[model samples]
Target: MIEYGFRLPSSHDNRPLKFEEFERHLDKTILVSATPGKYDYEKTDKKNIVEQVIRPTGLVDPIVEIQETKGQIDDLIKRLNVVIKNGHRGLITTLTKNSAEKLTEFLVEANFKVKYLHSDIDTLERIDILRDLRLGVIDVIVGINLLREGLDLPEVAFIGILDADKQGFLRSTTALIQTIGRAARNVEGYVVMYADKITDAMAAALSETERRRNIQIAHNLKHGITPQSIVKAVKDIAQHRSTKLKGGKKSDATKVPKEERLRLLAEMEAQMDLASQNFEFEKAAELRDEIERLQAEWGL
Candidate 1:
């Protein structure tokens, strides 16, 4: 049997993973990310690396502007107002959850339609919050590390990165690049770094962004094309809620015959393993949770 999987190079604590042990089990590997992390650079073959620079939406990369961090929050608010007036949206990433919450409050007081997202927010609310942001119910969204990746916001015209000079995992070159990519789907995309001094991370991010921007500009000019923002419709959360309810209506594990219950448990465990091997951690975690729930029902 063959197995394949993927993981972020860093752990939840922001330390590098011990890949020596992991590499022992694999014959081949492929590393993928919008901004490859340090481990990718150190371990992967540079010649084998694949670069995907052209976005299907034909959106040009954002213009990055460095601003003083002395009055970062106020500075972001002033700029976001212009984005809102233009019927576009803004995203702001701070360094901490407290900073995110504080900024959200400040934006609310300023009468801007805004919301803050973080690990503390419940899963259901996170879905609703993102849906609302896309639907224009909220003009601005604030987040910390969560805003760095897997955020698909096509209406985002501006990204305000606070504490951009702070050196660490949050300000790493990879993190900065991922955050900047959030604005890449919009025609009017732009990134504003609230920093007094440019760090190595910022410089690398700027250089890469410029490279991609130039390529995109050349492509647009050659094709006689105009950049356009993507418009993705918001999906209703109620459909997911209904699906959850239907899936929860399974037969009680304790009520099933012993042999059948064991068979079901075995099947689920196999699926969980398959999910893990396929690098679908979220699906694997869900299956693990379901297994535990079934075990509890069976009084195991």
Candidate 2:
């Protein structure tokens, strides 16, 4: 049970977690799981999860809701109506900016006070949108990639995930964890997921949710006193001077796709050979070390 935070496991995950030790660590972890540890699923024990004891936080177990298509917007409306009656605000996440826009448009036309936040919106507008949401001018907000992380809306009693089964990096376990986290701010927050199939990604997402929820509950049980909402302050790499990237050209290619990673390795080896011929031992040695490390990472 690692504290709730934004973490992406790296290739050689040998480093010790720096988070609070009391938060139970996970048995297996993948690239971006809300769970803990460095191993993958095979190494994890399902029985260990069953044995997990729970403690109560003052917050209630939020009612889970679900809403799917453009036609199912009414389901969302009913959910929202329940929250509004309780004087709660709401947040909604979509798979893409286009989807978010359509939902926002539909919600507004329905005469429900709403707004949207996505990459397309300018910074000032984002600030204004957030302000309006906080002030109660906008009862609901729709977002794609932006609001999933670093968003804390205490009044948001409802957090709706518009597409529960679309599978991709943005729809993966990590993103779903963040979207769900938005509702963790309120004591009575609820979450809704709308989809036809439960994807492997969704399976992973749900597993992590149950894992963390169980941990938090157990912690409260032992303490005797009710626990308040515990937020994991996310690591801001900008804070640590050493974490900043040194000056270099940015690569357009996001991941080192296997094909490209191999090509780059070959190119580096050739360049290293050339450097050795030119008596550039320093650069040659550096490239040699780089190639060796990459080979080890691939277990080749």
Candidate 3:
């Protein structure tokens, strides 16, 4: 079994899973991460440790640059405008949810298509926001913490990390590396950390990124490979899963009256709950997406 995001289960999150539990059940497992923790190293043998430093696509890690925090917002706006003009997206990571929201507002006032994502936003809505970014509905996303891991946005070319010198979990070496990795999918990947002084975390993150980048560059040169931006098909929820309600029955949402649509929505929501309790997550997700689609299409 391939255990991607192996750090989450071992992390000290709100409801962190016991990594030992997976060890107990799975006879053979492969743990994957860019920055594995101490426990992962201790659990595996030296011979078993596999390092995948070079990407198969020959895409090098982003070029990391540090800029002064003075007039950082204005600088970021100028940089984002250039990124958008090149038909690419940008990501900004702030320290807090309020900072993210305020920056998003300022960008909107500057006539940029931007949105903010934080823990306060509903989970489903966050998924929709990310889909919008992928589908080119939005050009920039300002977020905190949530943008660090498990995000695959190949269209993104620039990432601006605000307050990189801040000493905290959010600005730690691991966190900085993960955020910087967001821009790694594109050929023109680049990252800028706005900080007046370089903290230890920032220094380490920059060094490590440069190391990985050198390795990738050497590999590409040896093979005479040209890096290409990752091209992934953006799949909508409705396209991936059928819009038919539970029990495999299809309903034409357009024909339904407003009052009837509301009732149907409620029914589907209840069915979704039941599916959840029954541990039928795939069905529950299908129903949830269908509900969202109907709400958007019908303007419910």
Candidate 4:
């Protein structure tokens, strides 16, 4: 499955792979994404294109609004306060990892429970951070591109896109639409683009969102349906098996005898299987990497 084909180039070692490479290998292929790229369009006929504008849950797209960048942080704080008071969470996206962390720090100083997520964070820790947000342990999460796709946080009602006028990969139409979609899981979903001027990407994203929203609204009205926020049971994978070395202490896997190390590996393999079965792909990937590392270290 070529899911999130936009990021396929950076998916492995930052090297871009030509679409033909996959085309040669498979007789039939399905490219899935909300915003399919040019390659996807070229490969598939216009008649074959399928659109799923209305969600199965009847949730409509979030409302998109552009706000002046002046004092954007202050405005975000005020908005987040209201969302938090209503027992929901917020997401803030920045242009870079440094900006995300800095914004997270500023929010913390303002007494908002917050954290930042980016490529630099460990995979397992990232899972815990998301769980904390879902459990209301944190009110806001500042992130870069990591907050876009594959995240199902129904608690997030508000999304603040900072510096949205700047046109680049992160601010492109596809990126903006995906980021704005983060709030669509909630009935009160809303998006604020903090931009002084609207870019071409911003205009397209806004227009597309409005179109989808209208379709959804029409469908819901016809069916007499009210959108409800998705309720997902938060599963704690880290609680079952933690890979972190505690308090600068050596790992048990390293200090144990060869037989004990083998046993640990077996246990980790079992946990990885469970994580995969539970649809925790990120956690399963982390466990697989850790297992490889231990196998090489212990010569098991």
Candidate 5:
């Protein structure tokens, strides 16, 4: 099985699965990450570690800057304004959920298409929020910790890290690097760390970022290449999954009225039954999850 996310199970609080049992079923594994943790490194030899430092787009890593924490939110707004004028997007990471919501509110009042993401948001809503950001429906997304890792927004040119000097897991070296990675896909990617003082974690993260940036720059120079931003196609979720569901069409379930939602859920149930009868277990499982997600979103 291919493990998709960059984060290992140990990094998070919740235990979704027993790692022992997970490994027992594994004959072999290909763990991928920009920064490998101790656990994954221990599982493989040094020779097995493959470095893919060169992005196909030749996009370099972001230039990280430090700013004072005082009035940092306003500074972020100014930076985001510049990014917005350039037809790009920004990601903001605050120290708490309250701050995330407050920043999002302030930005919205400033006439920016903005939203906040946190643990409080439901899964389907989170998906919709991300999709909105990708489609340029929203120009900014504010989050506490979730924006740090596994968030791939190629259009994001600016990343603002509030309270970067705060000594905690959220301000750790690993967290800083991961957050910075969100901007790596864009040609104009840049990170602004709002902190009065540079902590050890900040120092380490900046140094590593600089090291990778130098390597990438040298490769580009040697190859006579110019950097370009990544252009990723945003997939229509329903349409993308429909191919596996046997000619199923797109669902506007998220946008429909309550009555229409119920009708769509009923239709999905019929499709689920057909998938099960066809011995398409995986497709049936996906339909089941989609049905449940719709139910949860609509409070059915």
Candidate 6:
């Protein structure tokens, strides 16, 4: 397992690893893996498996309410169902695919608008599911590992976590905090965890929740503005395009030559530089990836 560590590329450079350094390192690693003979996983005409994994971006958000586990999951669902039946949506996250599927089936058969997503769901279906949920076409989405990070839906008013005290990455303090924080994006959002005995992770999650809630409330009060619903505030989350770009346009990916690639690379570098100057690290990081994809022969 790789424990992520911060490495300064140069003494004067302060950004965490960006696409250029990461890709340059990738190229160096590929060079090392190749012998005089023929094939290598890194050198093959293939894309990286790690790049296929999704990473959603945003600040941490969740407002949680923990309950002791005497029929706690059922009770949590009942409360959440009331909110959903009344026209709001809820989310439930389990630690395993089996659990997510079972719960999704149970909820759907019980007449709630629900679906399950894991690595199994087709990419196209997943995109539709996300959009439908936002539009109120679905009331709940239950998932195992897929629900964490980068996956945002502001209309969800409740999040229920089952087996919160179970230990693992799926049940860790960071995981619970990230899951529950999904609800914090909405004004009336909240989380409920069904756990018989609270663990260290549970304790940490609760403390973090209280801290974030107080801070958001304080900010709202000081500004003399009411805290808004998650739905109302999430419009800026996705900056997706309406239609596919035509090939002749500058941003189109197909049919570009080496000259065009370098030109695009320089253009993206300027954006990266501007972002660094403005202290917008996330934007800078995105542009870095764009530059890499634009420059890569394999478009990896």
Please give each candidate's TM-score.
0.74, 0.56, 0.74, 0.76, 0.71, 0.60
After aligning candidate 3 to the native by TM-score, how far in Å is the CA of 297 from where it should be?
20
| Number of clashes recorded per candidate | 0, 8, 0, 0, 0, 7
| Per-model C-alpha RMSD | 8.7, 16.4, 10.2, 9.9, 11.2, 15.0
Once model 6 is optimally superposed onto the true structure by TM-score, how far is the C-alpha of residue 37 displaced, in angstroms? 41
Q: Residue 225 in model 1: shift from native, Å? A: 3.2
lDDT of 1 by residue, 1-300 (tens): 113335454433565557786688887888887667788889788898888897766688889999997877778878889999988899888888888898899899999999997776654466667678778899998888756455677888999998999998889887888888888888888999999999999999999989998998888888887888887776555654445445765655556898888898899899977654443444655666667667766766
Compared with the true structure, what per-residue lDDT tens digits does model 5 show for residues 1-300? 126677776666656668887788898789987678889889989998888877767788899999987887678878988998998989888998787888888888999999888776644466667778878899998888766455677889999999899989899999899888889989998999999999999999999999889989999999988998877787676664555455444455567888888788899998877654433434666777677666755678
Off by over 4 Å in 1: 1-30, 243-300
Given candidate 6, what's the lDDT at residue 129?
70
Query: Evaluated with lDDT, which candidate comes out highest?
Result: 3
**Angstrom error at residue 231, model 6:** 4.9
Off by over 4 Å in 2: 1-71, 227-300
Per-residue lDDT, model 4, residue 142, is 90
Per-residue alpha-carbon lDDT of candidate 3 for residues 1-300, written as tens digits (9 for 90 to 100): 126755665355546449776567877768887689887798788899988989989899999999999999999999999999999999999998788889999999999999887666644566677779888899999988755566789999999999999999999998899888989999998999999999999999999999999999999999999999899887666555553533354557668888888898999999987664443445666778788766766777
List lDDT for all candidates, in order.
0.79, 0.66, 0.84, 0.83, 0.81, 0.64
Report the lDDT of model 5 for residue 249. Answer: 42
After TM-score superposition, the amount by which residue 232's alpha carbon in candidate 3 deviates from its true location, in angstroms, is: 0.7
lDDT of 4 by residue, 196-266 (tens): 99899999999999999999999999999888889888765553335432222335555688888888899
In TM-score terms, candidate 6 sits at: 0.60
* Worst 10-residue lDDT window, candidate 1: 1-10
